[model samples]
Target: MNNPVMEQSTPRNVSRRGLITGTGSLLGSAALGGRALAATPRHGRAAAPGAAPRDASIADGAQVPALVIGSGYGGCVAALRLAEAGVDVQLVEMGMAWDTPGADGEIFANTTDPDQRSYWLRTRTKQPISNFLGFPIDRDIARYTGILDAEDFSGITVYQGRGVGGGSLVNGGMAVTPRRENFGAILPTVNSAEMYGTYYPRANTALGVAAIDPDWFETTECYQYARVGRRHAQRSGFPFVFVPDVYDWAYMKQEAAGAVPKSALAGEILYGNNHGKKSLQKTYLPRIRATGKVTVSPLHKVTTVRPASGGGYTVTLEQLDTGGATTATKEVTADRVFFAAGSVGTSKLLVALRASGALPRLNEEIGKGWGDNGNVMCGRANHLWDPTGSLQSSIPTAGIDNWAAGGAFAEVAPLPTGIETFASFYLSITRNPHRAEFSWNSGAGRVELNWQTAWKRESIDMAKSIFDKINAKEGTIYRTDLFGTYKIWGDHLTYHPLGGAVLGKATDNYGRLHGHPGLYVIDGALIPGNTSVNPFVTITALAERNIEKIIATDL
Candidate 1:
């Protein structure tokens, strides 16, 4: 059975709507025109007008126009724009493409399996790996893993994807735009309308962002999840709202017809959504590749970036799976390089590269101003109606903006599904913690993130009051400060990790390394502050905005 939704057009379908508005044919014609822009063989003759040149076939250390280290949303967008601008772009991803594993056998790239804990960073104990979410954290080399369990939780949990799509591969696939005030708080100089009004919609359109239709609630397990939210709201006397998820319904419908489950069924994600969910491996990269100039080499972890004597950068990369038979490494040169490996990877790389004197001339601000967006959480409700035989996997689709009312931190978003019966995610974009410090932990062979979170009297009061309001409503609700409980559960769960390589008057607004002209940080690390809401849309907007600047320079 085919997905009836996908096979047809709907008003909610932006492209279909665009067609009705006359823009559909325009986009269609543009795509039709782009066909001639396909990739040309390395040794072949010059390509047609829009054709992207092939860089993979080139010899070792090939010189390209742009080099993007991580193939996540940021890298993919940068590659596409640069390539379409006629720049030769090479996109390298640390994780390989996802391969569905068999029941008896295991596949290295499929972390979606129940047995793998590769998605969350966890403390390995004799007792199953326990984090705030209380889920097992498997650090398997297989399943194209990401850095799930960050050693430090005061900052953010910092979930990173290793495969072709980076965080997009394992993220909740929730595309949310930060509130106007939150966005302004971080990048004060940014014009709200320019980003939110214009760019935000464009980003959503390009990514095919849409809310899960009400039918998803009426016809599937989504309703069950909503019921859990409603019951909690009713019992606690707090309001509950539906959250929009980026999980493609059309695709999920198809997967269901084939007997594949959907994330709505308590399908534990964050480890990886085996059930059809929004993993970037299936989203942005393909169209970006279609621009013809972008080529992604999965399982290629970037090791270093050195400025070439004359121009551009020399990027070093290594294959992820040689069975560790040998750590074969390679390097290539590019006129421009974008680091989209998220905060942990990008900050670590920059800090290491600078500290090792690879780019000794980097400014003092190279690895300074690190923050985890001051995340805090307090959940209260007057209900204990935990639904059985259902998965509460999706987090908050809607949130309140009390943070603006002189409340605690920034804002609070709901935590959806979990191993336990009663748990909700509460994210705070409160007072930006005095930036965390970053250093290489040679003994651990990883970056060490250290920060001291101070409780602002007002923020704490606000947090407590927010819960108080809910408690006054109906039933019993509990308050848990994620950071306060860090000693026990190790920094409650946070999918959003930000800062490290911050942007401001200090660093170039576009996140270019202060003194290093060709180096740019396009990942979450570049975000100067955090938002109370999910940070994906904000990250995407910043990336999109930055790439536009990079291309305007034609470097």
Candidate 2:
């Protein structure tokens, strides 16, 4: 999706052009008469124009034209498009604003030195790489609302971002569009031509997706690890490809030149990127605020949704404190509601709502077709001669593409330990066919996913197809100290959780709930698990297509 013209343009130029030309009809009408609002304050700190009010909160008996649950990619898209259509929207998020800096003068904590700003409501941090150098690296932390949520189930741990921007707040910013050939498998019901020709490019342009300068990447000290990874993959006869990211490339260049404060160069992913990365807070949320038809309330958790006595849906929400305590309960009515609380959150809510007699007409597919996006991690112990650098960039630039041949695309991830580990780390997304289901457990009164850890075996094998060959070619072995003692595969967790309330089965072609006229599922829950690569770009594009149709037809 990288245009040569866009690659050569600076971020400032790109932003200006995108606002004027890329959004086109989507923002053109709204930009003319929309009242600009302040951006959603980060952790209560005031932000610039194009943000929601700092004290924005839904009143107990509020009534809105549209209510969007969760402020992630899909929710943001739905909110923006609906607002552009001149509808008033109230967006409720379960996480903090993250606009204010902490005592350490940073809005987000570093990955290596985490504090209360790391894990969500956990007394101890749950690092994806739980150990390093044969020792557990997990540490105790205050129980506060943090960025990443390492939600543990019976067999696997799902790491999710908890905040207004959703997964965009804590991801590696690898904005990838699936191959056109593979799009059929990704979303079989959708028209690939429209997606590729219009929505994908639209999403890419609005997302500020850009490729790194190839010449600079080849020589930057920060990307030495990626270069080494490329060498190993190419030497082993695997295809190495550069992936586009939402990060500000010009700012990254300045970071490399020591002209600005380092973010990607400093160990700053996993938790969140303080600078450079163009998360939803910088992209979609600002646009939503610019529409001036939306009010976003952070730290508000939706608990129940039922048909109102008069009409529409009556939604119950619990306002939460930083320590995960509910301080107030409120009710609001909306003519229409969009479920955009991610895959797991959306599925869990829908399942519970269906089973709890709130929305009994929901189909049986409410809790079905859930799958981890074939996420698996591993590290290779390189020879001492090829020591991975200590000063590594947190942003991943390249991946070993074995998807067509081996059903896996391995991101040459960074250790970013700030020390020479002589290890090459990777996060592989593979074609694992196993799909799990989320069911409501009445006795436990919670949503449960029957995702066994054994399901990851296919993913591990697929990833090994690339790494094993590289290891054989380079005379190396799998690193055993990263995940746990003697463990070679980090298969117990997934960063990309998809499906559950799938597109065709759970909703109509445009995300309208099958039984409910005004309810929709627009988040990752619509996808059936795998996307053949990173899933965010596809998610955004799909939401874009779905909302456009809904605005034209429904609204």
Candidate number of the best TM-score: 2
Span of 10 residues, lowest total lDDT, candidate 1: 1-10
TM-scores for every predicted model: 0.74, 0.92
Residue-level lDDT of model 1, residues 1-555, one tens digit each, is 011112112223323222232222223222212222112112233322222222343235788877888877777777777877887777876654544333332222122233323432232211111322222323222321333434344434454565566676566666777667666777776677789877788777776677766665555543454455455444543444455567766766554455564453434454455545555554566567677777667557778888888788887777655222225678788887788887777878888888777877766665666655555555432233443212333433444445555344323332332223343435444554456667767787766766544423333455544555544443333422222321212233345667778877335877677777888888788776465566777787878888888779745
lDDT of 1: 0.54
Q: Pick the candidate with the highest lDDT.
A: 2
Identify the runs in model 2 with alpha carbons over 4 angstroms from their true place. Answer: 1-44, 48-52
Tell how far residue 334 is off in model 2, in angstroms: 0.4
How displaced is residue 112 in candidate 1, in Å?
Answer: 9.7
